[model samples]
Target: MKAAVLFETGKPLQVVDGVQIPELLQGQVLVDVHYSGLCHSQLAEVRGHRGEDRWVPHLLGHEAVGTVSAVGAGVSKVATGDKVVLGWIKGEGQDVPGARYPLVKDGKEYLLNSGGVTTFSEQTIASENRLVKLPDGMPDKLAVLLGCALPTGMGLVFNEAKLLPDALESQGKSIAVFGLGGVGLSALIAAYTTQPKVLIAIDVEAHKLELAKKLGATHTIDLSTENWQEALQAICPGGVDYSFEAGGKAETIEMAFEAVRDAGGQCIFASHPKEGEMIRLEPHAFHRGKSIRGSWGGGSQPDRDIPLFVELYKAGKLPNLELLLSHEYSLDEINQALDDLEARKITRALIKIAGE
Candidate 1:
């Protein structure tokens, strides 16, 4: 198998060939990867933002779509030839550990490590829990987003915010999303589906903000040019009913929390800062009914939510969802994709592995 291996943290991934795939263990599924989506999590992993690299020389990637070529012992969530969406989020299946691939260097054999799910390779050994069977005829590229971006984004609004399309208040809810990455824009799109009275998108880039508008943001705030709190305040006097933070910064997390209305407003942050980083907030705000919480994959259940997300996309409820994937890079260009993601040059970069 061919794969982009992370030999070291804070370094470029080495696109290597002939990395040997070992026999699948219990609860594992062998997938021929079709497409992978790059997001901030991969950037953080490559940049060593999470503090340590104990998993060096490992496969990197979480969200992807692929075909099941084989199944391991005791695995029954999916079958051979089943098209599936590979994700980091756990679902109902046999829980298992990461896989190790064999690599030969100058006749010296080495082992490459991988998590329960990885996509930056032509083929991967994923735990059954990380696999979600995709429906027949679904676009592989778009389904790639289901693994992470859409699940987390839509989950933030649906699961965390509990904002249902038909349950919106008569006046509608006021919502604000801080950041414009794939996850943030996804939340923005989900929030839009509820017909929110005010949907504000905040970002440092003009292009992302513009895309937010087209995707359904009633207003856009340029963090580089304006104070987001003031801008948000000007748009919604009493603060928004919900604020979602995906900026991956402590300051933004604090700001997102503070932007919520004092009475029953909620703030949910899907991004995490570097390990050991701290976010400070006023404790008194909790007394006034303002609440903040961090989301784990937007509280998504891959097996359950991915199907719903697919249905919504098919129904055209998530209009222009394809626009969220702003760039595509071949598997060989994985390093460049990471660089662009870190530089905030693209909303989402698709990694074309073995997809048609």
Candidate 2:
């Protein structure tokens, strides 16, 4: 199998044309990847930020969608030829972060269990249960994205924050999204479905705000320009009912603390900030009934939430995420893809790989 292998940290990933397609073990499924999204985590691996679980001369993709070509013993959730999206999870009590994150390297295991996936190759292995089958005829590329970004983004709104159905008083309240990338925008789209009167989309880029408007955001603020707290207060007329930190920056999280209304509102931190980092907040941010919650992989219980996004997309409530796809590159072109993404040249970057 061909894969983009990072033989060393802080070095270019080599498009190794002949890496082994890892054999599936019991309870695993083999997928022929059709598409993979270049996640920030992959970039972190190349930059050596993940420290542990950095596989050198190893496949480095996780966001993917593919068709099942085979299943190993004990696998029953899916079958050969089933179109499915991939998910990466370190099962609870795994090599998760604490004072330290565990490490494995050089063609070795990186999980508490071997079933966690690595999706950056032509054929990959995943836990059978984590693969969500796409209904026949769904757009492969779009469904593939819902496999990751859409679910993570919208799930945070639906499951993590659990926004109430009613907007004002209950129905027309305010919600702020702190980043405008795939996940943030997807959250905005999900928040829009709840009909929030004030959906504040924040980003450093003006173009992202434009897309936010097109996608049903009630207002957009450039976080790079002025003080987000003042801008948010000016719009919400006080503090917001909900503020989400999807950017995973300590600074952005601080803004979330300031944007959320005290006493009855909540701030949801949707992504893990840098390792060993902490956000300093006034004790009062939570004293007046303010709640803080962390959203992990959008609180996805894969079977329940992944397909709902597909249904929502089929009904046209969700933006065709392919619209967010700014560039497509081959495995060899990954470095360039990251460059395009980091430079804000691509709104949602994806790389094409073969499944068929």
Candidate 3:
């Protein structure tokens, strides 16, 4: 199999051929990955932003849509020939360690590291718990977002914020989202379904903010010049009912927290910045009914949420879903994809694997 190998931190991934696939363990499943999504997390790993380098020479990627070719012992969640979405979030099935692939690079042979789920390669060995059966009629490219971006982004709204339905309340709620990346946009789309009285999208780029407006954000704030908190307050007096942050920076997270109403307002952040960085919050804010918390994959349960997302997509709730896939690349151009992602050249990049 051909795969992109991260031989070292702070360096470009080496796309090597003739890599030997490892034997499946007790709960591993081999997948023929069709399309993989490039996320900011992968860029953090390659740039050493996550800190530490013990897992060098490992496979990197946690979201993709693929077809199962084989299953290991003790695996029952999926069977051979089953189409599935691979993700990092664990679900039903046995939990197992990641698979290591043996490959020869520059006259040197070594084992490549991977997690329970990885999608950077054309063929990957993923644990059964990381696999979610893909729903029928979903496009291959769009389904890839279900693995991470949708789950995490939409999860921020559905799971974390738990936004009330318009029918449940007399008036629509107000909300704001910091950052217009894939995850942020996902949250914005989900929040839109609630018919919020005010929905604001904040970002440094003009194009992303414009896309947000088209995706149902009632207002957009440019962080490059405007003060987000002041701009948000101007749109909706006082503050919003909820704030979701995915700016991948601590300052933005703090800004998200401060953009919400002090009474019963919630702030949830899903981005992971570099290690050693800390977010400082006001200690007395808890008394005011303001709350802040971190999200784990938007608190998603793949077995349940993935199917619901498919239904929502089919119902036209996610009408602008294709706009989120901002760029496309091949497996060989994986490094360039990462570079473009880091440079903010695209919203979310899709890497064509076996199905290309």
Candidate 3 regions exceeding 4 Å error are: 164-167
Local accuracy of candidate 2 as per-residue lDDT tens digits, 272-354 = 56667788888866778778777778787777777677777777777655567767888778889977776777677777897
Residues 27-73, candidate 3, lDDT per residue (tens digit)? 99999999999999999998899886798888999999999999999
- In model 2, pairs of residues that clash are 166-170, 166-171, 167-170, 167-171, 167-172, 168-171, 168-172
Counting clashing residue pairs in each candidate, in order, gives 0, 7, 0
**What lDDT score goes with residue 255 in model 3?**
89
Model 2, CA-based lDDT: 0.72
Residue 276 displacement (Å), model 2: 2.6
| Candidates 2 and 3, the one with greater TM-score | 3
lDDT of 1 by residue, 226-325 (tens): 9777888899997989999999999899989999999899999999799889999999999999999999999999888988888888888889998999
Q: What order do candidates take by TM-score, descending? A: 1, 3, 2
In model 3, the number of clashes is 0
Q: Which pairs clash in the backbone of model 1? A: none
lDDT of 3: 0.90
